[model samples]
Target chain A: MQPVQPLQSVTSAHTDRSLQLTLFIVSLVTASVLGLIVLFIFRETLPALSGPGMLRFVTDESWHPLENQFGMLPMLWGTLASTALAIFLATPLGIGAALFCRYFAPRPIVRPFRALITLLAGISSVVFGFWGLTVLVPLIARFEPPGASLLAASLILTIMILPTVALMSEAAINSVPESYSGGAAALGLSKGATIRQVILPAAKSGIFAAVILATARALGETMAVLMVSGNVVQTPGSLFDPIRTLTANIALEMAYATQFHRSTLFVSGLVLTFVIAALAIAAHRVEHRAGSHHAA
Target chain B: MQPDSSVSCAPGLMAAPSVAGSTLLTAQVHAKLSERLFVAAVWLAAALVAASFLWIVADIAFHGFAKLSWSFLTEAPRSSGRKGGISTILVSTLLILAVTVAVAVPLGVGVAVWLSEFSRRSSRTARVINIALDVLAGIPSIVFGLFGNAFFCVFLGLGFSIVSGGLTLACMALPILIRATESGLSAVPHDWRQGAAALGLSKAAALWHVLLPAAAPAITAGLLLGIGRAVAETAALVFTSGYVDRMPESLMDSGRSLAVHIYDLSMNVSGGDQAAYASALVLIGLLIVINAVAIQLSNRFMKSRIQPA
Candidate 1:
């Protein structure tokens, strides 16, 4: 009986050690998957970068595949333009809605209103694009010749990102200590004055981080932008002009692109990955600083 | 004296007085007016946000609700989705979602258990893993499409099939699942662990019998969230899964997900708008149901947790 008990304990201890090791290996997949994605995407981009010497891809403006012209400036411009426009349009409305929900909204409706926002966030991007195509495009076409343009894409993007911005901003505003408002009230400040002067300042970094993250989302949006944007490979001179963003370019061309053209699309993907990574890191840093400031 | 007294008193009150008092009263009134305007403006913004949500839902329902029928839900799309139902697409979507959940849940739960139960919060490895998960969560789906295309389709020889798409989505879903599950596990009371140790229960037994059930609600919520994300995905699946609308014979055969089908019908197919509307309606309905269930489950679990035995 004593010998059997000793063997049983040894086996159980061995199993426990193995279980921990197995889980540790499983956890490593999180980091490895990310590493593999970066590695694979970078490897695919090497062909285009090395073949075109990187200069032509950057400096050239047109992206005709058969002619061997692979300039990404126009797509780059489109991505930057549409993302900036969407952020510009969404920021005020989102922040305002956040302020309303936190400070002005009736207490009973707040939870439902937030759930509504979450639902909006969960709606598929393709659905938003389809709606834009079916509804928004026609409305725009009433005023312009082609309804599908950079403007339509930006508008759809604005709607898609509105929930993200609003939710995050609401959370930011909520995080500002209640004591801050109490302090303002003690100083005899108006409710509006207190919100604007005290709460907003305290939540500024968090709100800024939220907007930055939303910008990254707008920049990375593909299917909706692909569906609504005219997919014209040109730098738009006006908001109404047709344009193709980097993401749209990759999605549209990757289906049939071969060798060089395919590699170029990979290059576009690589560029997007880098930009998004940078934005995410920046947002994280800002959020971290805000958190530390609050703790202090 | 009146002006000074008014200043000292609650700002809401206005007392009648002489010339200096009148100016002060006007200033206070102006501030009050601006405050009213600002609040009104904020209310307008919130109203606009709500209005847009209504507009989208109403428009989709108005246009697509009439087209939905028993046939629409059960038949395979025909004529580039100009006619017929989305039965096959539904199958493919479920299958892909199944593969995604199967692959992601175990791995995610394992990582979560390791992080919450084994690793210290301030450990270097834990920090690295957290950062990696953060970056992974932020990566765009289209990039995942590129990687899936390059690695899974070409390098792995999986081709453009459901398996490829599912694995890609599993990668995309892992970070969110892990984060949610980790938080859930961490939320379990320390006393429970101490009790399990005092009882001489093995770590695995305690986790299986005690910790997992407590965290089940959160894990389920995370799973539903991942499913919602996978169902809504278009860019990631299009390249990884390929765009063949025919019923996929197996995991190896390319299958078009609902999102990708909607994209193709609306963007590429002429005269496919009615079907696109129907498909979009179905897609949105599925998401709402998933979200509602998650909310209900979590709420019920929370209430149960709060109740004394």
Candidate 2:
């Protein structure tokens, strides 16, 4: 009986080891693929670094790649400004949704409400873009110079980030120990008072993390903005003005571009990636700080 | 101007009365004010969200409904952008969607199953994989397109083909699929595992019997969401999938998708605004139908998992 049990145990160990090795290889492959993508992007962007007017191209706002002129400042401005608008538009709606779902909504209603936000998140950017083009562009035309403007892109992007913020905020709020709420209750506080004072403050760090992630999402958005934001190479001062985001610039012109122009677009991508990474790092820092504080 | 995040509140403020069902003047006023403001804010957001949809739908219904025709869907794209149906683009889009799902779903599900049922989340390897996935998910589709173009289009010489685009899209769906699978597997009640073991089932058998079935709905929801994303993606496919208007004969054929068609049509439009609007409506309609199905599933199936509060 002892000899039989040892043989069975050895077989199981072999099976488990094989499974683990196979799975590890797959995950590693995925990681390597991502690394490869970054490398190739940098490789593509190299020529643009040495192009005739590389510095001038980025420093100036004029961005006609044709006729030996290329400037990325307008693209940078449009991307930043539009993303800011999206963050502003989404934050309140998301926070409110989180608050309602966490406290006010009934158990049955809460799940459906959360699902609706997630539904918005699942919708593809192309569909969002199409929705923006047919729906948002014409709608914006009434108030804007170009049918597709920075504001239209911002509006669409707000919907895109809403679910991320709301879900994250809800998780943060729920993770707060009930003891905090209980203490507030023992002190003779109203539900709203407790939520505002004890609950929100405790969850502030996580909420900030969520907001930062939403900001990253807004920055990373491409298709929907490409559809709604007028693909103009100009720095937008008014919300209604035609504008080009860094993302749209890459998507719209990458097909037709040649030589140094192609590399410059990749460079644009690299810069955007760096910005996104920075935002992610900031969010990680917030979560890390919160984690340590909670531990302490 | 401010959404309250403050913790300092007036103490002794109707703690018992609210629970005991008594209303004082000051407390009543505060409660009334709070309720009014909260309700207003929440409902207004809902309305705003709803309104955005309405504007899009109304515009499409107004335009596309007027011009709906068999020819508009069946005929090949024309030089005028107004003279033909989106049949070629539509078919190509469908093909790409099918290929993408076929590849992405199984691969995604397999990895997810392996991750959730096999690996410990606390392991350094798992943490690294998880972080890598998060970074991949956050990378812009445009960046994905750039990579696809450079590696697959130019380098591998899979020049502007459906397979190239579909492969790129599979990466975009990975995180969603993995996250969903992880959450779903975790959601399977722990007792089920113990019960299976008690019945003398192997670990794999237990997972297949007790866990997979339970997690199926959630995983399917995630898959559907991935489908929705794959359908709506444009950037990564732009360079990889050539703007060839013909239907793909095989996975190697280059083709334009609905989104690309719209971009091409809108940019190249010469005669009128009506054509762009009409095409936009078609694209939006298709997307709405797809997303609405996903929404229904999630709303019904993932109730406990969602965070509203």
**Where does candidate 2 chain A have its weakest 10-residue lDDT segment?**
A1-10
- The runs of at least 3 residues in candidate 1 whose Cα sits more than 4 Å from the true structure, single-residue gaps closed, are A1-10, B1-10, B13-19, B299-309
What's the TM-score, to 2 decimals, of chain B in model 2? 0.81
Which ranges of candidate 2 are over 4 A from the true structure? A1-13, A50-57, A102-115, A127-148, A179-192, A284-296, B1-35, B69-84, B189-214, B270-309
TM-score of each: 0.95, 0.83
lDDT of 1 by residue, A1-296 (tens): 23336666677667778888999999897679989999999999887888535887876658988888888899889999999999998998899989988888899988788888888988999999999888888889899969889999999999999998999998899999989999999989889989889999999999999999999999999999988888999989998888899999889888899987888888888888888888888998999999999989
Chain B, candidate 1: TM?
0.94
In terms of DockQ, the best-performing candidate is 1
- Residue A202 Cα positional deviation in candidate 2, in Å, after optimal superposition: 2.7
The TM-score obtained by model 2 is: 0.83
Candidate 1 global TM-score: 0.95
lDDT of 2 at B125: 73
